[model samples]
Structures are given as C-alpha cells and as structure tokens.
Target chain A: MSFSSTDTYIVSNALQLAVDAAVALEKPLLLKGEPGTGKTRLAQELARSMDTELLHWSIKSTTKAQQGLYEYDAVSRLRDSQLGSDKVHDIANYIKPGKLWQAFTAKQRPVLLIDEVDKADIEFPNDLLHELDQMAFHVYETGETVTAQQRPIVIITSNNEKALPDAFLRRCFFHFIEFPDEQTLRQIIEVHYPNIQQQLVTEALDLFVQIRELPRLKKKPSTSELLDWLKLLLLDPPKPGQLREWMSDEQRQSLYGALLKHEEDFPQLRYLRQG
Target chain B: MFIGLLQLLKRYGVAVSITELLDLLAAVNKGLAGYSIESFYYLARTILVKDEGLFDRFDQAFYAYLQALDEVDISERIPNEWLSDPLVRQLGQLDEEVLKQYESLEQLLEQFKQRLEEQQERHQGGSKWIGTGGTSPFGAYGYHPGGIRLGQASNRQFSASKVLDKRQFADLDRDAPLQQRGFQVALRKLRAFARSGAATELDLDATIKATGKQGGLLDLQWRPERHNATNVLILFDVGGSMDSYIEQVEQLFSAASDEFKNLQTFYFHNCVYEAVWPSAARRGEVAIPTGDLVQRFGSDYKLIFVGDATMGPYEILYPGGSVEHWNEEPGAEWLNRLTHHFSKAVWLNPQPQQRWRYYPSINIIQELMQERMFPLTLNGIEQAIEKL
Candidate 1:
C-alpha cells in the first residue's frame, strides 16, 4: 500500500479531494478540462490506484446512450429468421450487451471511463440518467432488466463542447482540472522523466510559460505538449553554463512547432520576442 | 449546521434537492469530510450543486452563510494593501520603465522574497517598493516589465508575468428582473436553426416507413434535434471610452451568453488588435490571438463587434497606435481581416449614431465596417441582428 509504480499518479490535494468525494459518495466523477489536461488519464490513474479493472468507453459524436445500454441486432435476427435458424427464435441471442451492461454485471466494481462525454449530443447524458441513477437498464427485446451486481466507479469526462442538461449534471460530482501551476507541473515532469536535469526543466518551464502568456496565442501549449517539448529538449541537452541564456530564436523556432500548434501564433511569438 | 447551510443555499435559489441533502448528510456520517470548513464546503458543493450554471449562486450563498458566523475568508493571496494605495494613484505622469533586472523567473521570485522581508510598511508610487503605480517587479496598476501582480484588479499593460490571486467571476445580476424586453427580443433574432449535431431525437416518419418496409418488424430511426446552430463571435471593446457603458455592455453580455447556443466572447480595447482576452481577470495572463479566432471559427459565424469605436484616428490607422501596447499592425487592418473572414459582421457602437459623425475614428470604423455599424439602442440591435 505504501509503495507501488501504479501510484505514479501525482495526487494533488485538489485531485485527491475530488477522488475522495467521488469514491465516498459512489457517484460518477465528471471531469472537465481543456484538451490534453489529463481528463482521460485521471480515470486510468483512478483505476490503477483502486486496483480495479478499467473499462474505457470512448464517446464519438454519433455515440448514443442506447448503444451504451444495449443494441438489438434486429437485422441479424431477421436474417436468421428468414434462414429458419433456431437462434432466431430466442431474442436474447440477438441481444448484444453494451459497455454499461458489462460494467453492471462485472464481478467487482470496475472503473468505467466515459471519455469525451461532450463529443456526443446534449441528449446523450440525459438518455443515460435512468441507467446512471438506478445502475440498471432494461433490454426491451429480451424483456430482461439488467441490474448492477457491483456498481462501477464511473469517470465521465467532457471538454465543455456543448452545454450538458441540468438534470444530467446533478447526478455526478463535478471537478474542473485547471492548468497545472509551476510546482505541480514540475512534479508531473518528474513523474514522466524522473532523472531529468533541474536547470533544463527550469529553463524549459520558463520559456514555455512565456510563450503561453504571449497575448493572443491561438493555442497555448498544454501539459502533454510541454512534456513532449521537454523530451525533445532532453534529447540534445543544453550546456549547464548556457542554461542562463535561453535558446536562440532560430534554435527555439525549430522546436517552436510543439509549443505553438497554430501557424498564426508564430508571427505573434516573434513580436513578443522582439518587444 | 449542515441543515442551516442547505437552507441558506435554498434561500438563494440554488435548488438543492432533498436527495442531494440526504446524500450530503450520509457523506458526513460516513466521515468522508474532515473536521474542516473547506473539506465540508467541497463535499457539500459536490453533492448539492447539480449544474455549472448554479456555481455562482452556490458560491454567493456559501459566502453569505460563512459571513453570518464571521468566518468569511478570501482565498490565500498576496496582500493587496501591501502593494497599492488606490486613493493616491495619480493618473497623469505614470512612471513607465522596463524592469528587466531579474533575468529569469527564479531570480524574480528570489528578489520578490527578499523585498517582502525588507519592507515593513505599505508604500505607493515608488520605484523600489512592491507597490502600485511604480516600476517594481511586483503589484498591479504599475509599469513593470515581466512583474508578478499582487492584486490591484485587472491588468492594464499586459506585463504582469503572473497573478497570485485566485481568479473570480464578476457577480452577474441574474435575479435582476429583465427591464429590457426589446433587447432580449433583438438577440432572439440572431438564432439560426439547423439539424447538424448527433442524432438524438427519434425521426417518427422515418421509423414508421422503416417499420412498414420491414413488414411489421420494429425499426427505429434517430435524427439530430433542430437547434440554434448559428455561431456568434462577439468581440467586446473594454476599458477606456467604453467605461461609461459598463452596465449596458454587461446587460448585452448576459443576454448574448444566455440567448446564443454557440456564442464565443472575447475582450479587446478600443479596436481589434492582434490579440483579445477571454476575461478581464485573465487579460494580462493570456490573450487569444485574433488570427486564432479567424482560424478557429468559420466564416459562417456572425461577427458582432461591441465597442464605442471612438478613439484617436491614429489608433485605427497607424501601427503602434494602441495606447496600451505597441500593436505591430494597425487596428484597421485587423478589422478588415475580421470583416473579410466573417461575411456577416456588424459593429454595435454604444455611442449615439448622431454623435458618430463628430468622432473621426467612428467614421473610419464605419467605412471599414461597410457602414454596417449600428447604435446600442434596442432598434439598432434589432436591425443589426436582422442583418445577421
């Protein structure tokens, strides 16, 4: 319990509290954040921490709540019926149990990651209200009610693409993952690159922050991008003596693509550097 | 104590359901929350608050409840009074110096720490002390190249390297009775409906036809709901000249945020520049580039410019014209880019149309806007929305 590689999840006080609240209340933890802020990663970390099986359900725009509950393969059933197969007689044979059904029937409580719940329409969350509330859903084709043997530790994430209904929101404990500060970011870097040079990390963080603060940057470099940039910097490590002076504009510009995703920001970045 | 807190929240129209209350009590009983006010606050909020929209109302109620017990506390922040004395802040002849002594952030923090120890009392309008209206590497309302702002409200120069205070949203008057019905009506006209999103609603006619084709076999069909698909990119001109119309602008902000489904608001000063802030608190901290807005949002988005459009003619025409920052490009170029990118755009000038002729800058903006500039009056907004 004291030591494990699975505990690589750097539990900030805020994150710990959020996890604690969600676990204690047995409610779905709704995590909202900007892209690459570790919303999906948090679910995996939670599962690893709890020593539970992780069940990921990546949501697409076309994803529906009904698909999560159950999908009736009527075409297969109709074809089988036309073929005069014995399997067609039983509707349960054609009933495909969805991720929710699998989670409900799991032997132990599993961590269900409903990744990018906002990618789906506004009604997506609303449609799952009954199943989420009761931890159960009905299979109309088979006339069977699928109830949870052990309620899954549900972690739903959203990028706030669209406004979720008020009713759907009330069911879960919400947590907004703000961009990590310098201290937390350092720990995060340490988690990824354990034996990285301190001066390099400091200088990289400094320049990274400066670029983020540049007025009217189209896309600020995210946590993942910072980590990715750090990896690139670590490859060709700068001299310890030259750490005081930031990388030259030309040198920086070569690696600038990682920091600034948008081409429009390149000109602004130059302006910031000069002024 | 918990019940009293719940009651207070209810009184503030937070709509905390009975089940949520019971769940909160259950959590307390289970020893989930530590014997701390903050832990209790988080736990209660997590249980009670259902929607993000109610977060403001919940925060207000929580503060009011805490205030009753004389335990109201602001988040831990660098002392504001230690930095500035706002009363004595002289507008004229403000010291403008670029403090680049600290080469790096670590060095800056070290200097700040040393200064924090040496200074015993508050000082204002000084070059040395971490006070306002000075060239110190700390505090706001001062000119410091890459300084950490202690408090002093929103950033003016966009030079504060970092802000220490926990950012808070401006308390919107949501409960205030809608005094302007015409304004709301005008905003409603901006709605453009489309069935573009994921299929969420049952297409009854399609389902029926599918069922008939399948010879009595139940077939289901889903079609996306018809929603207000109009994308609105609203750029609000804040600070200088626009200060008088804060109340009016706020009303418009509130109405637009409520009415439009896909509304994106950005703040600029006087005219469109290279960048715009998402909020006033984050003005200096981060700026989303105007180019990014053009790239992010398509030409379909109705670009609505909310500003007085009244500034020096040089401000719009000449580069480095902006009083705050030395904008590399002229304001007119950016406005032209915005108009070109967005086929549907209108400038909502808070200034009266009659007074527009007096201001040369307004006339310049009108020409760039293709004479699509309208007054902030109800009728003017109606005409603008109709044109959109």
Candidate 2:
C-alpha cells in the first residue's frame, strides 16, 4: 500500500529526534525496530522523496563484507588474460564493484539500503563503517580510492537480533521504530483498505489489538500482517463453517503459525474465533 | 613540478586504470590541510597519465608510496595524543613500554641466536653441568641446585584454597536467610515487652502535648506503638533461561513475602516493562493494567528487578523483544521510565559481578539504572535495602 510520509504516525519523540539527526548529519539513518514495524518501507519512501536510486542489499547471516563491496569474476578474468597477454596486468579489466562501492562512486547519488544488517556477521558492519565515516573507499587491487562524487544516502536497518558493537553503532545515525498505536493502526487500515466496511475494520482492529496483547505470541501481528488478514477476510467473509471450509489447508496452517507460536495459545484462539 | 606531475598522471590514469595513483592523490588531498581541488586535479593529470598502458602500473606504485607515507605519519603520531585516549591508555603501563621494548629486543635476539648456535656446535656433547672429574664442581657429588628433589615426594601437596563460587551466592539454601533472620530477630525483640505494658521510654513530646489539651496532672496510660514495615515490590525474572535458578529464586521470593507485611510479588521474563501483573498463576495470560499499577503502588514502593541480565543487547535497543511477547521498547527505556517514577529502584543480577562488564546489554541496563545493580545475595539484598 502507498503510504505518504505525512500519513506515518509520530509515536515517540525519540523517532522524530532520530529523523532530525539523520537530516542534520546528512548521513544514512539506521532504523532499528521490531519486525513488521515498517523500518524497511521508511527508507524506501525517503529514497523516493529524494529521487535517489534505492539499491537494496538484503543482508543475510552468510553475507560477507567483501561480497557487499565487490565480487571478483576470477574465471572470466583468467580466460581473458589467457586470450590476450597484453591485458593481463590491466587493473580496470579485473575490477568488479559491489553495491556499496558503486553507490559511493555513482555519478548521481543513490540510496544504499543495507537491510537486516544485524543478520550479517559482525565484520560486515565494521567493514562498512570505514566507508560510512569518510564517504570514501580505496580499491587496493587497482590502487584507486573511490570517494563519493555525489554522496549516496546510506540506510542501514537492524532488527536488533544482536547488539551491534559500539564502534559500529557510533558511525551511523540511529532511530528506533515503534509499533503503531490503535489510532494509527486504524488510520493505516483506512488508508490502505478503504473498500473494507467500517464494521469489519473495527472488528479486525479489535481482534488485532487483542491478539497483540496476547502474551504468548513471539511476534505481534505487524501492520502488514493485519492488512493481509483483512484482505483474506474481505475476499471471503466468514459464513457458517466458512473459516474451516474457505481456509485452505495451507492457508489455515500458515495463519495458525503466524498468529500462534506456542501450543498453549491454540485453546485461546477458540475464544477469539467465537468472538 | 612534482605537484604538476602528480596532477597530470591522476587526470588520465583511467585509460591505463592506474587506480593506485588516483587513490594516492585522494589520500594526499585528504592529508594536505589547505590543498585545493585544482592543484589535486593538476597533479593527477601530469604524472599519472604517462601512457595508456602505464596507468595500471602507476596506480600500484602510487598506492605503495602513499601507504609508506601513512605508516610514517602513524608512527610519528602514536606516542602522543593517541596514547592518551582512555581506551588506548587502558593497555597498562607495562604493556605500552614492553611493546616498544619488544621491537628493539627482537633484533638483538636474532643476532645472539647465530653466536649461540656456533658455540653449541663446537661444544658438541661436552658436559656443561659436570666439573673436572665424575664429581660435580660445587661441593659434593650430586651437588645439584635447582633440580628435582630425590626424596619421597611429599604427599602434602599444595592445593589452591577453595573459593566459594560467586554463582553459589544465588543459591538460596547455601546462604543464611537474612530476611527471615532479620524478621525473627526484630520480632523477638518486640515480643519481649508485653503488648499492654508501660513503654520503657517516656514520650515527653506526646505527654507535653496531652498536658496542653488537659491539665498538667500526670495521666499515665502506657501503650506500645508498632511501626509499619516498608512495602516491597519484588519483580522476579522467571522461566526461559531463568528456569535454572527458579527454585532458589522462588525460595528467596517466598522468604521475602513472609518476612515483610507489605510485600507484593510479580513475575517477568527479563525486565519490568509497561506493567507487572499480580496473578502469578496466569502470568502469561494477564498483565496488570498500567493505570491500575500506578494507582495501587505509590512512589514509596521499593522496586527490585531480579534477573540474570544476560540477553542480546538488542532487546533494550529495539521494542518487542520480550520472551513472551514483543515489548514496546527496549527493556532499558521501560527501566528508565520506571526509575523516574520510582525513587528507590535497584536491579539484582544473578550473573557474577566480574562478567557484567563484558555484556553490553547488562552494561547498558546498569548505566540506565545508575549502576545500582547488585549480585543476588543476602548481602546484596541488604545493600539494596540500604540504598533504598
């Protein structure tokens, strides 16, 4: 769903302070929030407003520092070297820049989105800090230091899976994204799914709020999850045996899995369904 | 001329892709305080673009030169302000001096090694320990000093004294029940005097005020006054990893409940977030509403957060990291707010005091709570009481 920056809820003054810090510092802002709190979408919107290319790098646990900077095509380079001995020592011929380096050296500034940075190993953040600090990096292979001609807006996101080292955290401007309150949640629902009836919206919101308050769940239903479930309900409004019949085996299982993390919570859901 | 050559080479190094040359120029530009962009550009175009083929070769050479310069600059700067920064200064006085000494000593060791090896070869199988004859040079035969003893080895072996593992302090049974003991001692002292008996000490101020109301005639009806005990809100972290210490911590909680008249108990996973509920039975189900909690408990309530502050530090940085449900904010923010609302709050960590320094999460929590974290021991509880 398309959400304007104005439409976003200003829950805590801390979040606004973080945004202001990012703008003042002119650095890529790192938003650390719970999963489904729209940390990623915030960067996307910011990039859109700035008219910068959003080069997203979805970091995984296995993502390496070198992989983020550049990947060498060793086999291709070797073949080319064999074919032409004259170009064997050419530095530019072998250089393959990664998103971080490309964004820094881009003719027009781009937004380098390092998503889920906490998932990546500790070394990844440490390696990025050098570039983040000076807005420049030296390519050792070619003996060239690529500085930002037009600095790309850098945004790093973390789910707080682990504590980032102080050295790494000190380099970037940080913000924490909080979950939307009931009013904000209602606004979001109205903005995105306007077609849904008011009664359905209220019922869904009440159920969603109750579900969030349920102590057993690991992840509270994020706004995105609420919207998805709302869509599912609207497409096929519950009839007699509708929840059982319309909910495909896969769909039902997935929904159950999302809503409930523990076995004990299953019995609690019976009451929710009845209500 | 040198600057012009450097500028010329940097401008056209792209053809040969002398990246090193460009990097060197960039580094130099960064290092030079007042160097203009025009001068840097001029230097890059002049010396770097000698020929298209030479671009890559020049880049490598340029980088090597800049690196050597950087090393020299770093070495020159190391002994001054860099050494004074608290983080670097913490390496200990011996370490700082020894590191410099080792660099010089390494060369001397290499030089001495050659001479030692030659002497060893010439001596071959010669006896260094033996004197002229079969007997040793010292006084008697077998007059060996600093050697293994020959007599029956002493069965009285030296053993390290058993240090009580600090972790045992968290074990409720091992330590004396101070709360219970204190309560018993106080009760015993109070019980010594009969309830209706004349108080040993006269309340002169009360007697004077009574005289003001009535006549100055001595009206003696002695009654002992009982002081109300202070209320305590002990929020014990239970379940998950805390399951290990559940029995011991529960004993402490139970003892506290029995000892204090106004003792209230609650359970949390790691920290006290928005609200702590009363029903320990349905801890996972019901939470005491925030409004209700504030109304019921005044600023007088002494808050003791009992937990092993061992978790991913992110829980404090991000909201929604509770073991059961996503907390709205990092536990620290809630902790900060709670501390502001309540004057007397202390955190009792089960983890050893030494290890708390390493865990960033614990350190953060400790900092937020004004370093009022104490080990969960009898002494710790007493100290917490004193602080409150």
Candidate 3:
C-alpha cells in the first residue's frame, strides 16, 4: 500500500510536544523509546514531511566520535608525501568529512539521524553534546572551526541500555515514543499491507495484543512485525489441506523469535504453531 | 472560574478541604458551570494533596484516559505514604520484635555452648564411662575414651618449634593490593603537581607589604600555593537491588569522599526521581528538606549518578514505578532538571560491558543520558574523576 501523511499516527501528547519543540527551537530532536516503537521510521517520516535529505548514521557499540565527523585517508596522503616530500608539505590535506560534517555543510538542511546512540561510547555522546551546543566543530588539522551554515535537524534514538549523562541530555529536547495500541496497530497493518483480509487483520491484532501482555517476551512485536506477519498470511492464506503451508517455515521461525523470547513462552505459542 | 481559583490555591501548595475548594471556586466570578466544578475541584485538589481517596479516583480517571488512548494496561500500585505515622509505628514495633528475637537467640546459643562443654568433659572419660557405651552424663553420642589425642599427640595443638618459618613462605607484602598501588601513584602525581608549581599565583601584595615592614629590604621569598577547592556531588545508588554491588561501590564512594572537597553523598535506588535523601535508612526522615535542597544545591554542582540502570523501563516512562516513592513524573524529568542545574554529569554502571544490550530499561536510560553512561571500571572512574 502507498503511504500518505494522513496514515501516520501520533499517539501521545508528549510526541506532539517534542515535534513542536523541534520546529520552534530549530534543534535536532532526540527520541528515546523501546526497540519496536518505530524511532527510526519517525526520522524517515520527518524527512519526507520536510522534503529534506535523510542522512542515516546507524550507531554500533564500537562507533567512535571522530568517525562521525571526519576520517583520515592516511594511505593516499602517505603515498603522495613519500613520492614528493617537497611538493606535498601540508600534511593536514588527508582529512575527509564524514556524515555529520557532510550534512552540516550540505546545501539543504539534511535530517541527520543518529540511530541507537546508546550503543556508542560515553565519549561519542560527550563529543556530540559539544557540537550540538555550539552548532560548530573545530578541525585540528585545518586549524579552523567549521560551523553549520544550516543546522541539520538531528534525531537521536536509544533503547535505554545505560543511563546517559545529564549534561548531554540538556542539549536536546527529549521525547519517549511508546508502542501503539491495538486499534492503531491494526490500522497501521491495514494501511501498510492492504491485500490482507479484514478478518485476518482483526485476528492478528487480537493475537498480538494478547501476546504483548505475556511477560516473558523480550521485545514486543512492532508495527513492522505486524505488517510482515500479514504479508506472510496473505501470500499463503490458511487452508484445510495445507494449514501448515499458511506461514513459510522461515517466516514462522522468525515470527516466533519476534513473539517469544523466553523458554516458558514457548508453551504459550503452541496455539499459533498448531494452526 | 471558582474551579480555576481552587486550582490556583492547589498550585500554590495550599491544603484545602473539599468544602473550601468549592467555596474558593464559588467565590470567583465564574461559578460552577454545567460540569461538576465541585467534583473537578475536589479531584484536582486530592490529586495535588495526594489524599488516598482522591488519589485513587485520579488514578481511575488516568487509567480511563490511557484506555481511551489505546495504551498498554499499566497495573501499578500507588506508593504508601513514607511519612505516615502508622508506618513509622509499625517499623518501630518490627525493630523491637527483632531485638527480642535476638535476645532469645543469644539464650539458645548459651544453652548450646553449655551442652557442648558437658559433652567434651564426658568424652574425656570422667570415671563413669568405662563399663558401658551407654548415654553418658552429657546425654550425647559415642565418645573417645580420653578425648582422641592428648597434649603433643593432638593435631589441634601447635608447638612453637613446629611453626613454619616465615622466610620459607612467599612474601605477601611484596604483592600489595591494586588499590594501594593506585593510591601511591595518585599521591606521587599530586606531589609532582605540587612541586611543578601548577597551583595558585603567589600573593605579591602581601609579600611586598611584609618586605616593607623590614625597611623595604626583601625578606620573604614568593612561591605559589595550591588552592584546592573541588566540589563533588556523588549520588550513590543504595538499598533495594543495589545491595549486590555495595562493596565495590562503597570503595569508590569512600575514595571520592576522601579525595574531593565539598563532597556530598545521597542515596537513591535504580534512578533518581524528584528528590534523593541523605541516608538510605531514613529516606522519609526529611533529613534534607525540599526547600533546603533546592536553595543550597542548584545546577552549578557537578553530579555523578552511580547505579546499575537495571530497572523496568516503565520506571522512566511511568510515574509510579519507582522503588522508593511515587514520583509525579518519570525519572527522566528529574534527570533533565538535574542536567539543567549541573554543569557536568556522568552515570557509572557497575554491570559489565557485555550485558548492557540485553536490558531495555538501561538502554532507554543511556539514551536519556545522551550516551554518557560509562562502565564502572578503574580507568572509567579515573577518567570520570579527571573530567569532574
């Protein structure tokens, strides 16, 4: 199904407040929520709404602060300097701007989405805080401070793994996005994957609501998972002769992972597997 | 308009009865409209004052709102009043009961000791156990005729000549504790900094004045001295689940307390919400009054929140999930306020590096912290201290 602006649902007043702040303050909005709460997709939607370039930075545990700003191309610089030492005197010429710097210097204000910031080290957040605070960063090699011509709207996402320092939080407006309710989740599924039967949609949402209440699950199934499940059911609708064929084995296994996380939860999934 | 006036009074932290709220609301030009202004006034007043009956009604209304919004059903209980007289009385009674039980336990222990001594005497063959292997005067099991071994033959006895020479064993002093080494290194660095004159500028005016007293002839030699005024706010997580990592955390807490000037410590569990008390034992004692807290310490202090952020994610999302007390807002709100007040802040997590990813609550906190949470390693602590 083709997506539209009206299709997007804003559940909480807090989220609306955050969006308003982002617009008023002209600052990067930082979103914190659970894993399946559509934090990354919000950035995509925001980019679509503003008609801006969405520069995505998927943060990992090993992500470094310097990597976000600039990278040093030492190999090429070393070759040139060695081949022609007298000609290539300026050693600082090897620095190349990374995603953050590129977005800052872009002609249009890009949505710089720093996804899963909690995965990055403490230094990374500290580094970003300074940049966010001043809207500028200094390149030691160039001996010049590069300021943003147009401040890129930055969105940081985290599934609270560790307690972030308060100093860094003060720099940005914060918002928590919770999981959508059953009605909203159903609407999302129907809007995203239209071919699914209404009955199937209702049944899936009912099952999802029930499953979410189960304490053993690690991460609740998100909107994306709901759509995925519907797509699978539509591709191979349940039949008396081939009830087992309704969900592909691979899809079924992956679905279980999304639904069940604990050993005790396996027994609860017997009904789903039986059909 | 009357309801609005009542709300104003409530906001001003006034304790108004239901009738008073209605009267105040009625006094205003805008009297009770079609809606139950009296009811709404009472509801809002009870919510503000946190009256149990009113609070329950407010909670029901909140739940209804959540239901309408299609949010998850959050089944949580409102925290009991920490300052309730009944609760305090019950705690005192419990303490008294515990003391009485301890005394009874001591008496039982003495009786057990007496029985043990009698058994030992009987085992040593006190003239009556030679004929039969029956129950002796001690009223115990089989015994040795003359206790198993006597004098030099006893394994328990250690003679001075039999003691092992210390020189033959490995020298334990050579391998000192890591904490000692770290302390020594820190001391050495402090001494070096002292010697290098990386301190306050000398008081030239005072020196010149002193020299003038000696007929303008220079008698005093000028040297810079260190003006060490390090202000530290160490927010330690104590009580509840924090009991597990008390030893290591205590070490760090003590170290920071000794090293920094103006070092203040407060106890919190999981995450800080609203206010933190000075002592964990008397969290509800009102030791640091709310007014005093806000006045004495604002945002200028450097805050260090020490805890393992292993809590239900709802603790930050919901108001009532906190362990110590029910906060009106989520823990994040308090954290945000703290950040606004403190120029520098850092979180120290004792949980190891590998396990942080598994906990959603910790992940959420880390994000709130702007990814400023660091593992509580030796190097991490040092870096944190240096940053402070």
User: What's the count of clashing pairs in each model shown?
Assistant: 3, 28, 16
lDDT of 3 by residue, B100-203 (tens): 33234234334434544443222322323211122122111212221211111112111111111111111112222214223322312211122224534445
- TM-scores for every candidate against the unseen true structure: 0.61, 0.41, 0.42
Quality class of the docking in candidate 3, CAPRI style: incorrect
- Model 2 misplaced stretches (Cα beyond 4 Å): A1-17, A83-87, A239-258, A261-275, B1-388
Candidate 3: list runs displaced more than 4 Å. A1-13, A85-87, A239-258, A261-265, A270-275, B1-388
Local accuracy of candidate 1 as per-residue lDDT tens digits, A32-54: 76678888888888787777888
The numbered model that scores best in lDDT is: 1
**Sequence-dependent TM-score of model 3:** 0.42
Tens digit per residue, CA lDDT, model 1, B251-365: 7887788778799988998988899899865456588888999899999999999999989999999999998899999999999999999999999988867788999999999
RMSD in Å for model 3: 29.5
What is the DockQ of the complex in model 2? 0.01
TM-score of chain B of each: 0.53, 0.46, 0.46
RMSD of each: 13.8, 37.1, 29.5
For candidate 3, what is the interface RMSD?
22.2
Name the candidate, 1 or 2, with the larger lDDT value.
1
